[model samples]
Target: MSQRRPVPRLAALDGLRLVAALMVVCYHYLALSRSWGHNPVTVFPTLHRFAEFGWLGVEVFFLVSGFVICMSVWGRGLGDFAVSRISRLFPAYWVAVPLTALVVKKWPEVTSIRGWDDVIVNLTMLQAGNNTRNVDDVYWTLFVELKFYVLMAIVVLCGVTYRNLLIFCGVWTVAAALAPSLGFPALAAFAMPQYAPFFIAGIAFYLMRRFGSNALLWGIVLFQLLLAQRYIDYRMASNLGHVAAEHLPSWPVRLIIIAGFAMVGAIALGVFDRVQWRWLCTAGAITYPLYLIHMFIGMTLIHHFRDRLPAPVLVVSVVALMMATAWLIHRYVERPAGQWIRASMKRGIEDVRLNTPARRKARWRPSLPAAPEERPLHSAGVH
Candidate 1:
């Protein structure tokens, strides 16, 4: 059995999943609040402007995803990685995107996506900047995510390995840092190259698996992310977009931020893997669908009830309602989909096999990658 691939197991990552989903929900709440004429900034003392940076929760997710998915790709070739990713992400996303446009917002523009052309491109999971004209903009991250997955899958499948992944990360981080200076926001070759660091960092972290770098890394990242918010891009404040990475730190800072978030995710994965609560675990399972749908629901609810609901009460109620709805959706939609996918993947696929001892012998370090040989065969790698 290749140590690089391993079987899937349930862990407390669910709770963290729930937290990230809620953070995004709250971030959207803040955005909706402002949109609906209830800017908490003016109404509530001590309220921060971008309390909505909670949407950065997706970054945490990206980091964790990179780490976990890298392992999945390490042993097997790219095809398996691609299949796994599509199976894991597409079912939910394909359902979610159209769901957001039609089911929640009911916008006619969604009809723009009606034919085989857009549907084929979307099903391919390759369009991010090219297809940003959708009704729900938040989905762009999923596109970025899908791109990273595909890129990573290709690199791993080519047998280029971490030495190559590291080079890819370095080049990616540098290019992203210099993206705007080059006069392109989309950076035709990469997915919003600026955000690539987060995804790259996750891949690097998974390969390295270093524990010595933990709290300090995260503290610095928190401080920096907070600091970046301070230099708000007038555009964002003008409701166009407040910050742009137009003048971000050098490559070192980019790597540091990636390292920082990677640490945050790895520590989270380690600490919560042993939790015993079913509800908490269940909450984690629905995070993707919850994340996908909550903004529309929350924003819609905020728009409709803004005049009647008290500002603070509306905020709290929306959050609570969204959370409950997330749990329900998890039970009804996400869990079933994940179960069906896993079952199909497990029952039908003929891939590498490994013993439980091999898995138990595998070690996970904070923000570091496991050597290919060091990872267990089945669950270790997603492929």
Candidate 2:
């Protein structure tokens, strides 16, 4: 039999989510030159140096997500899994997308509006898959996330046992490795060679958490870390210009990635299991909304106030404002909206179930052959 371990509440991960969101926030506000309408490197020389590495936080988020998702979906069916994901992701996203579009229309500095077509498409959260522009650039990650969810859905369908999960990790790792050499776009999209390692490592770590680490799990994590490094140049080139990317050493990025792995490893090993505090959950509650709304909206605010406020003051105020807004959205909007979505989706899924042929047959009756016309029996020989 496959092993199972009781999942524990890891509030520290919630805190970690907030930290990752802040890292990306800092990177966007402090290190990204284009968004500021001037080189941030010149504006905040010292902070920029540190903030430049903050994009690694996204990697950390992916790792945490793999662990969290695997944990959440352990005993869930596909419908339940879909409902959970939809409920969790869409509530804040539905608000953030249009709010961002309106803000962009109002400011028009952070990015140009491609039109309502893009806005409509962005609402689906499949904009990245459709080759459409995302209203907020941070949304590109959502598409990657969606693909991972699809992959996991398959695992969920098969059942998320320890043995099956090990098979999944191995198959996915092999696929991700082969994706680059095969020149298959579909395979590459699904495997996500650049990002797969983080998610895979996260799953492996979770496996270690559940079943206890073995040579295989340890090997998978270590192998993925090495495989992950191959994409460093690709990430740097895409994020920074090739010339500017060349100026930055890859080691810092590599080290940060390693640290992210180490942190999750620590979590899997129960290092942070007892470090729980209630506020970390609240911090986590705001993370999704903050990440979704921060980019263009914060940039627009920064662009407008660059001359009016001190850089430090402006950045602090904006981050605080964003966090405050995220909290409001989480408290006032996400919880209720998520509940509504979950209820609505569950009802809809139930409706589908009731309408399926098998379910209909189970509910069906054929009148019991009219009780065999009830008249003829006992008189044939000896009444």
Candidate 3:
């Protein structure tokens, strides 16, 4: 039997989720709207294009989700792990999809699903995805994350030790880079291209705590960020990779842009700024709901009125609406639902424990039939 390690607990980790969720919110702000999207590095005469690069937020969400969830199961058996994950994931997502469908009719395309197929794939949460397009537009990475979950969970179910998990993730991370050339189209799918490394990096962090890990484990993050910027030049520039060879002469700019994507993750988790706000952290609590709702409401409100209102004030109102709406949903809806599901799950677990047959208590029995009781002790004392 494999020995289990103590779970790594960190207060700051919750804050990371908030950061990730907020980053995703930023990505949505850039997405979901034609006029106000963000592109982090606009080409000449396109400085405002930074808004479209918000999709990076989704990538960040996947990395953070994989990392944290894997850590949750680090030393545990994989038997019930997948079930638990699916249970938690499907409930919220199932509730959200119909609502999303109501937002805009599914965009029909050869790449994306048109009517029923999209719903089927979206409900199953298994669209492998093509190019930058997505089911529900925002849900592509969820499927990718779920796919990774299933794959990694299966590996763990077969008794892959933590040490083995480390080696596997490390190897796989490197392999994800070469995936497109290797012809595993799934590996190079645009929505989730070559992202297992970032997620795996989080897994390695878990194993580091389980076994003895050094400062270098942390340094990997630093190195990845610096290398991405200085050498790769592949930041959130969507199609920049195509023109990368063309811009070989402009390697310096490429390096910096590439660095942005890498550093984006590091800084997101407090690598860049030391945040100490209770309320901003409070906003992080509602960050998930905020992420889901912010796109449609915030963008529509902003786009229609940005021309009328000051940009800074408009930005504030959008953020304020997002926070307020998220809090209300979280307080009245998301929290209650999460609590109910968790409570029901807890009850089910307890029921399972209670229903399991009690171990039959060993009863006193004669080992040997010939054995007999001695005469009364009172007679012996009188004698």
Candidate 1 residue lDDT tens string, 88-110: 67566666665555544353321
Which is the winner by TM-score between candidate 2 and candidate 3?
2
Give one digit per residue, the lDDT tens place, for model 3 in 225-342.
4433432334434423445335444444444334434443443343433444455545555766666656545555666665788655776788787778667766666656766776
Ranking by TM-score: 2, 1, 3
TM-score of each: 0.67, 0.91, 0.63
Candidate 2 regions exceeding 4 Å error are: 1-8, 357-383
Error of 3 at 318 (Å): 2.4
TM-score of model 2 relative to the true fold? Answer: 0.91
Candidate 2 worst ten-residue window by lDDT: 374-383
**1 versus 3: better lDDT goes to:** 1
Tell me, by TM-score, which candidate is best: 2
The local distance difference test score of each candidate is 0.56, 0.87, 0.52
Better of 1 and 2 by TM-score: 2
